[model samples]
Target: EETDFEKTIVDSLNIGFIPNFLNSFLDVLSTASIGLFSVLFISFFFLKDSNLLQSGILAFVSSDSEKRTVHSIDKINNLLSRYFVGLLLQIFILFVIYTITLFIVGIENAIVIAFLCALFNIIPYIGPIIGAVIMVVLTMTSNLGMDFSTVILPKAGYVLIGLAVGQLIDNFFSQPLIFSNSVKSHPLEIFLIIIIAGLLFGVVGMVVAVPGYTAIKVILKEFLSENKLVKSLTKSL
Candidate 1:
């Protein structure tokens, strides 16, 4: 009986579809594997030579300025490390929230969908939109043969609501805390920067705004300590 069911499914599928799907899947897997390996290989070297940036800086600076240069480098490293670590924690928290919510909604592969969406958080404003779209697609496909009203609509609606709530928490609580504590910037300052960046350059602008602003503040404080604007902007730093 099981053999007949399997045979029926295989025969019902378009002959070319299976081959094409397998080929596409294989290609994607191969590409992802290569990229993953490349990142790991590069990360290993970066970790092993953690002092590479300091060494490079020292090599470029005069002997008399070495101390100040070292101080600046250390400050930048500390600030960036905190920012990145906080970002990771925020993403993890969001992932857990999304997974639990989707599971409650009776979505299949809830964990996987939630993970992808949470990971997209790294991309800033555009990430959530993309994640939500992906979630809806996954939910619909998972219930492909089910009654639309009874299964699909409810599942998809719940998934979307969950994503919306998760994003709200992230934006209001997680993001503000991370930006304020890690970057030593005021929540209002971070908010304004993001808004301005989005206005000027769209999604990419918003994504890079915080780090870019932090870097600028650090550099200005280091080089233009006497400047009034620099003093005010970098007081926290």
Candidate 2:
């Protein structure tokens, strides 16, 4: 029965797997392409006409707090813009590092794989783990017929080491600098916020944690200027 089951799987793969995989991949790619263009257009509109968002938001502000609200909004906009640009640079740096490592290991389609994996790093704590798993799976599959113990394991190990280096730089250097300079928060504060947000609200929470936290800090500083904790947190802002 086991042999028969194995044969059935092999038959399915031989008959339909490649085409099915390609079709599914194309579907995902098309959707992602559409999302990418939509995001670009929206970002361009917001960046070009920044006051449109400000005006819309300010409509809800009380007349007494209007001046303070406008100041907070300006600070939020500047900080978030820097934060996002820093994130893009971080991903690009990882992509370059991963590409170099994959090329050195002679991995096929290194650039595309590296870029995809690098993009995964945007998700915070869990992102790198997912990227590493995908990287290892792709690396092994790229050399499917090779000896698993000798060729595949060693190559995957090399890629893992490369990933570790990229992660170290991101965690220690890139992240701290981005958080401090862009958002005016301690690395530890941002890390804790991201973890707590992830636990409570999942991946989406983690993705928005920094921006949300930064906005909150800005608001708190504006309204609670006399509070000691708020003063400490937002002093750098």
Global lDDT of each candidate: 0.77, 0.84
Please, what is the TM-score per model? 0.74, 0.80
Local accuracy of candidate 1 as per-residue lDDT tens digits, 1-237: 569889989889887887897687556444433443453355345435658967986998999878777777667667766787787788898899889988887787888888877876766666676677778878888888999999999888988788888889998889887888888998888879988987796555666677678877887788889999899999988
The CA lDDT at 71 in model 1 is 75
Q: After superposition, how far is residue 106 of candidate 2 from its true place, in Å?
A: 1.6
22-58 in candidate 2: lDDT tens per residue?
6875664444445444544665576568799889988
Task: Candidate 2: list runs displaced more than 4 Å.
Answer: 1-49
Give lDDT: candidate 2, residue 10. 78
| Candidate 1 accuracy as lDDT | 0.77
For model 2, how big is the CA root-mean-square deviation? 5.5
